[model samples]
Target: MRISIIDTSSLGDRSYLIDDGGVAVVVDPQRDIDRVLALAAERDATITHVLETHIHNDYVTGGLELSRLVDAEYVVPAGDDVAYDRLPARDGYVIEAGPMRFEVLHTPGHTHHHVSYVLRHDTQTAVFTGGSMLHGTTGRTDLIGADDTETLTHAQFHSVRRLAGELPDDTEVYPTHGFGSFCSATPASGDTSTIGEQRHTNPALTSDEEAYVENLLAALSAYPAYYAHMGVINAAGPAPVDLTMPATVDPDELRRRIDTGEWVVDLRSRTAFAAGHLAGTLGFELSGSFVTYLGWLYQWGAPLTLIADDPKQIVEARRELVRIGVDEVRGAATGAIDDMSAGSALRTYRVTDFTQLSSGIPSDATVLDVRQDSEYAESHVPGAVNIPLHELLARAEEVPAGEVWVHCGSGYRASIAASILDARNRTVVLIDDAFTNAVELGLAA
Candidate 1:
């Protein structure tokens, strides 16, 4: 028996491919299915099943398309109100693929329909606890709603305890969300752990149900704004991902699109974006956290034009955006901002350090903190309004009337906020310095 882990680092999500004597089962696949197909070919395995633990809220699942391509059964939780056809997986139902056997276990915590699959081959056992259990923590239960938060958190406690009590100590545990994922109540300690290790170390297992629910609810951070659309899209069935490069448009075409109010996303370094960019363009660098902010600020299904330094950056940006169901990439324009033939003037923002900011901020200027809510609660510059980068676009109007001074934990997110403020034609100052510098430089934090 062979098991392969497919880790998507940007979203901090994992999928699994378990192969037994040339037959395989795929669990919690991402939008890009090429890697899964390539793996199957390398192992000379026939994909017999594609399993989903729940209708994912973080990203689009490729399970439906992958099963269609491979002629395999696509299994989804029985209670999910999805429009597409799938094998209804219920608790205790067993599926066999060659020497491997998977038993379904309903675990309704992360979502009302969530389930875990336990696979066994000979004496070895492994459980794919998607969004229910993690290395040392459990999945966050707040994604559903404020009304269901306490209900789901309580459900999570029983679900986790059930796994620990029913499974053997040595059983291998593979969870879908953790390993730096915001989906977890806390950052995962490691990528993998056994039932025994998690039972001993996982806080969810040690705490009483009431305390566990309280702590779990308190620990959740704000998830991506794009998350609200994922479950609905998944339930309706997402379109197959198009891997081909988007059409390349000239400056005039890009200008025409922008004139019609289309979003122009500039994928460049924060420093590069601050130096110069197309006026009104969103500065979303193609870094690890790119998708998080992109999904946060971007209008779903709205036509989008991409501007990058090169073709490579556009390709990378598109790959990440599609995972969260932002597939309306109309076209792209590649070159430095100065090289574009469009008649519009290049725009730039003034970036200052903490020392300069500490000297004195303008009385009318608003200090915007673009970090997470938790980070703001820990320590923030005096008089700084907390509008996390992800929520800035929706709440930008709420910012007081004045020049906007934006700062994040690091300068990265502040740069993003600065760009948005610039697009809104607000005079902006980016505090492109570490947050700790604010305290050390004698600024109240």
Candidate 2:
């Protein structure tokens, strides 16, 4: 038996390709199925099953499309109301692929119909616990709804304990979420762990059940805004990924697109963006957490034109964007500010350090904390209003008039927020310094 772990580092999602004697099964694949297909081809294996542990809320899955591409059985959980035709998988059902046998265990906590698959061949066994259990923690239970938060947490506790109790201690465990994914309650310690190790170290297993639920609920962090659209898109079945590069548009076309109220995302370094960028273009640095922030800020399915430094950058950016279901990449514009500006105007914003703000904040300026709610709650400048960077586009009007001074955990998010404010013609000052220096800088927290 051979298992291939395909990791999408940008989203921290993992898809598994398990092959036994030239027959393979893919689990929880991302939108891009090429890698999985290529791996199967390299192994000289024919894919016989495509399994979805649940309807994903973080990224669109390629299971349906992959199944059609390979002529494999698309197996989905029994209770999900997915529109596509699939083999409804039930609890305790066993599936066979070549020399392997997979037993389905209904684990309903991350979602109403989540299930884990236990693959067995001879004396070796491996469990694929989609979002139910992690290496050091369990999946967050609040994504579905607030009403189901407590109930799901309770279910998660029992589900986790059941897996730990029922599975042999030596069984290898694999989970889709938990590797730096927001879907996890906390970051996982590593990619793989044994049932015995998890039973001893996992928080969900070690803590008291009631206390675990309370802590899990309390520790739940704010997920990306694009998450709201993922489940709906997944349930309805997303179109196959088009890996074609977005068309390259000239300056006039870019101007026309921006003039018509389309998103012109500048995927350059924050320093380059702060120096000079096209007016009305939103600066999202391509170097740091590009996909997370872009998905957070962009309107789902909206026509978007990317501005990159080169063809390579555009290709990388589009790959990241499509994984989150941002498929309407109209085209790309690549060049210096002079080349892309045409006759249009260029804009710049002022960046300041935390020490300068500590000395004195302008009386007319409103300090905006653009970090997530949890980050702001942990420590923030006194009198700073908390409006996460993701929500700023829709809630910009709520920010009072005057200059807007923005700061985040570091300078990255603050720069993005400052660019948004600059595009709106608001006088903006970016606090570009390490957030860890806030206390030493004598800023009120």
Candidate 3:
């Protein structure tokens, strides 16, 4: 048996294409199905089955669409009241494709109906624990609701133990979440792990049930606000992803959109965006974290537009947005920053590093730290106000008036916060440097 990992690192989730020379099975694919199709073609294998561990709460699942396209059986957890037709997967259900055999294990933790697939061949063994048993941690339990978090965490503890006790110690472990994904209960440790390795490393296995439950609950932080919409979309079956570029908008239309309070996002480097950008445009640099934060803070169903240094950036941004169900990117404008400004002078903010911050901040200048609550609690610049980047949009009024200087762990969130502050007509300076620099410079308290 051979397993090919399909990593959507931006979302920190991985899909798998496992085959035994002739037939393949895809597990937990993202909304974009082309990548899965390309992998299957490359392997010279036919897709016989597409299995989903659960109705995901992070991104739209491509299982239904991929199954339909490839004329394969779509398998989903048995109890979910989904809109589409699927092969109901129950505990102990066995699926065979060529020489590969998959035994369904109902591992409820990430969701009430989550399942893991144990793959077996002549001698090789592996388990795809979608969100149950991660490398070092488990999937977050609060995604369902505050009311159900404890119940799920308890179930999560048992689920991990069951996998550990039942499966061989040498079984290769492949989890769907935990690689920098908000879905993890805590930061995931390491990359590749085995059942034996995880036995010693995973909190679920190492800690007692009560202690594990308590610690998992305490460690949970804020996840994306957009997650509320993902499960509903996935359960109903997501539509085919449209990667085609949105229509280009001229500078006049772009200005009109911005003036009307529509979301006009600028996808460029944080430094470039801090230097000069359209007055009303937001700076969400086109990087791995771009889609996650943008989806979190975006006003759902709003007419969204994009501004970029190149059209290619906008194209990639659209692909990322579609994964989280940000489908209608109304229009886009790309080119020189000055040209996109439409006759009016572009707005600019001061970008400084921690060295400048270490020198001295003015007595009255408000220092805003836009990292998460947990991050700010660890350590921060003295006298800096803490409003997490996700909360900044709603709590902008809470930030004190006059000459606000903002910083985050990295400058990405700071640039985003700075742009929002700039849009509100506040005097803002962006600290575009790593937080480690502040500690090195004796600025962190």
Candidate 4:
């Protein structure tokens, strides 16, 4: 069997396309479906099965669209009623597709209907241990309809224990999620593990059964509030979305939207957006995982437009928007900021924070402390003006420019403050490290 593991790291996700003799089965796919389809076509393989271990909450699933693209059988665990087309899968139900033989095991704990598949090839064995049985820790049980943590924990323990007894020691284990994934907080950092290694070192199996239950529950990080709604989105299926890049909008058209109250998402590198962008556009640094962070920042269904640097970055921005169900990418502004000047006035500046401001004295600039009333009340630069970071979008006119110093408690909020002010066409100096060394200089003086 040939297996290709696709990782959605920024979203805490991983998936695979396992091929048994030129026929493929894709497991736990993300919204970006083209990559999976392209891989199958390149290898001359036909995708006969699309399997989802359980309904996930982190990113939208593309299983339905993938099945549509490949004309494959969409299989999910039984007991949950899902929309779109699907073949119900249950425990001990063996299915065959090409050379792949699947032994489905009902493994609940992560959810009431979670299942793991044991795949046997001609020469070797492998298990698709979904969210239920990960490398280190079990999937968190607090999501979906899981109300009884203790009950779910008990079910999880039994599920892991069941795997130990049924799957042989030599069976290599492939799970859908890894450590960084919110699916399981303490997922093993590495990609793959064998049943033998998990038997010996998987945290849940190694700990005492009772302790395992308690520790697993205690170790969980903060779960996202959107999880409940996402569960529905996953099981039901995502609404049709455009993965192809949207047509480019004139930069002048983009400015019009901002004027009418639409949000202009600047998906440029922080450095690029910091240098120059149209006024009132929100800057989000796009590098590792845009979809993941976008989901966190906005409501799942919020409408947004791309203010990318140019044509190429627009594709990246649109893909990210689809991943978290924020699919309305009216389109990107071609020549972005440059397009603005011919039609309307534009601006630029360097972003900085309190730490940067404290390090040096321009000796002839005004310091703008963009922190809140509460933050300012605790401590603020004595001579610095107070305008909290959140309010900078509207209060930019108050801060004096011409080598203006912008700062926050540390440098994070300060950079944002600087960016907002810079977007307003001011020459601002960053004082990110100002307070850290302010007293030392005074003493020296």
Candidate 5:
């Protein structure tokens, strides 16, 4: 059987087109379904099945749409926890595609509905291992369905060992997500791997249970607040939307336009953005919900240009816009950071503790807390005002002006909040806390 691995780089999600003669099946498809259809047509294969490993939390799954287009069966592992139309998958069920056999393995840990399908050929075997097992890690069991992380962690252990032990020694492994994704702790480097390679070198397999769990939590990056809602979108899926590329602008013209009214977005890494970023631009770092934040900044669909230090980074920024449904791009600022800095107003501040903040909070300064209402009600900076990070744009009027000390649970939300205030033409400092560190420091002017 011939197969093609489709990589949608934005979400680090992959889909497979498994072709056995003129019949094919797609697994874990991302939003752009046209690509899959075109590929199938090119191979002169009829796509008859769309197999979902689970209801993903990072991006919309295109299984529903692809099935609609091809009149194919949309199949997923059988489970009562969630609702899905089409075919339900169960353990030991074998599907035949001419000469190829798809052997189902009910491996649930990353999620309860998750499944791993082993493609058994005449001589070679490959496993479409979604979140059940990855090259460097296993799935994150702490997501919605797997409530008790501790228990789920142990369950994941057995599931990994089962796959490693039972699968053919030469079986190749292909996964759905990658390193930056939240599904697996350390998503595999390449789109595919072999069971033997992962069994020997995968960190999660090598470490003991205690060490493994501790490392998983430590490596867990801050997922978007919107990730919790992604299950709904993935279940039903989205109709294919026309995605537009940003219009290119002359470097000088772009600068003049931004100065007049356009916004600047620095679509770089979080570490790159934290070190230094454009004044008044959101510091979200081109992750999921990046366009959500852009909407927060410019709901008017205001024309904006990008300021990616790396020339190729403009493409990355544009991908984020299309993912979240933001389409306004005036152009990208070209040339060196120094050239971009010229004739442009620059805003800069350092992250401060409550002690340092105490010296800055006064008539000219104000403190703003960006945690959710419940977090704020439980404990927050004394006298500090509330404006949950997500709702900042709509409630901008409620925010008091002047030099501001903004903060959230950690510093990520605070940085995002600070950008909001910065765009509103306010000078702000970030207080690295979810508590009254802002209040104690009196950073809000």
Candidate 6:
């Protein structure tokens, strides 16, 4: 069997397409099925099976839609209480698709119903670990609930050991999560690894079960708020992804939307957004973390709109939003900021590097560190107030009255915080620089 990776870097997850002979099976596809279809077409393979390892908690699954489109069998874990029809996949059940033979293994860690697929063809063997045994760690056990975290963590330890014990040392490991995903119990290491490599490096393999559980729990950080919606949508079967452009809103309409407290997001670079943007519009630059942060802080089902320099940017941003089930993008505006300003003055903020911060900041300025609580505890600027970016919207009232200077690990998140403060009519300056520079320049205490 030949395997192809379908990476959705925005969410730090990967889907897989494995083909043997002329038949193919897709595993853990995102909501947008067009990319999977295109891959199958390019490979001259027919999709005969769409498999979901579990009801995902990070993004809506496209397995059901893709199966219907290709007339393939939709396979889901037998233990899940899903709403749609599916082929129930259970442990030790073997399935055949052309030359590929899949043996299902019930690995309940990430979610109670999660499973992994071990594929065998000719002389080669590989395992598709959806969220179980990741590269250097296991999938987080806390998504289900705080009450079940310890139970699942124990199960996770045994599950990883089972895979390591049963699978051959050379079995190539392909996991769907842990590629910079918050789903990981800890940050994943390396790009690719084998079962043998994992036995040596993975925390589940190297540490005792209790030690592993304690370390994993201690390291878990805040996940996106949108995650609460993904499992529900996936269990109910997600709607077909809509990638068509949203209605174009004129400058007047854009202004009205912003004035009415609607979500009119600016999808420009941090530097560009910091320089000038529509007053009251949010700056969630269309970058890797755009979907993640926006989904985290967004009011669910809100009538969203986008502002971009080009129509193509909005199109790309729309695709990202759909994966997280933020489907109510009501309108878009594309072109120069002046054109979309609708006769109002564009808001602007000053951005500077950390070296300037090291020299001196205004005595009356309040230094706002927008990194997470865990990140703040590691090292931070002396006397800087810590309000994580995800919490800024709800805690905006906590910011002190002064010229507020906001910053994060990189300037991306700080730009977001800066926009929020600017929209609130607060005097703000954005520290648009890497946090490492702050430590290197003796700015962090």
TM-score to true structure, per model: 0.95, 0.94, 0.99, 0.78, 0.64, 0.99
> Which wins on lDDT, candidate 1 or candidate 5?
1
The candidate 3 region of ten consecutive residues with least summed lDDT is 356-365
Give the per-residue lDDT digits (tens) of candidate 3, residues 1-445: 6799999999999999998777999999998999999999999999999999988999999899899999999999998889999999999999988888999999998999999999988888899999899989999999999898999999999999999999999999999999989999999988799999998999999999989999999999999999999999998878888999899999999999999999999999988987888898899999989999999999998989998988899989999999999998999998898888789998888989899988887877899999999888898998899999999999999999789989999888898999999999999999989999998888888
The superposed Cα distance between candidate 5 and the true structure at residue 88, in angstroms, equals 0.4
Model 4 off-target regions past 4 Å?
145-150, 224-228, 341-445
User: Which candidate would rank higher by TM-score, 1 or 5?
Assistant: 1
- Candidate 3: lDDT of 192? 91
**Residue 426 displacement in candidate 4 (angstroms):** 13
Q: With candidate 4 superimposed using the best TM-score fit, by how many Å does residue 155's alpha carbon deviate from the native?
A: 2.5
Candidate 4 TM-score versus the reference = 0.78
Residue lDDT tens for model 1, 1-445: 9889999989999999999788999999999999899999998999999999999989999999999999999999999999989999999999988888999999989998899999988999999999998999988898888899889888998999999999999999999999767788888888679999997788888888878877787788788778999999899998999867799999888878766778998888888888888877888888888887788778878988899989989988888988999889989999878876487788888889889887788889888999988898888887889998888888999899988888998788888889988988888888888988887877745
Cα deviation at 185, candidate 4, in Å, is 2.0
Q: Tell me how far the alpha carbon of residue 252 in candidate 6 is from the true structure, in angstroms, after superposition.
A: 0.9
What is the C-alpha local distance difference test score of each model? Answer: 0.88, 0.89, 0.92, 0.73, 0.70, 0.93
Model 2: CA > 4 A from native: 355-363, 440-444
Q: In lDDT terms, which candidate is top?
A: 6
Error of 2 at 393 (Å): 1.7
How should the candidates be ordered by TM-score, best one leading? 6, 3, 1, 2, 4, 5
Residue 414 Cα positional deviation in candidate 2, in Å, after optimal superposition: 1.6
Q: Which stretches of candidate 3 lie over 4 Å from their true place?
A: none
lDDT of 6 by residue, 146-200 (tens): 9999999899999999999999988999999999888998888887889999999
- Backbone clash pairs for candidate 2 read none
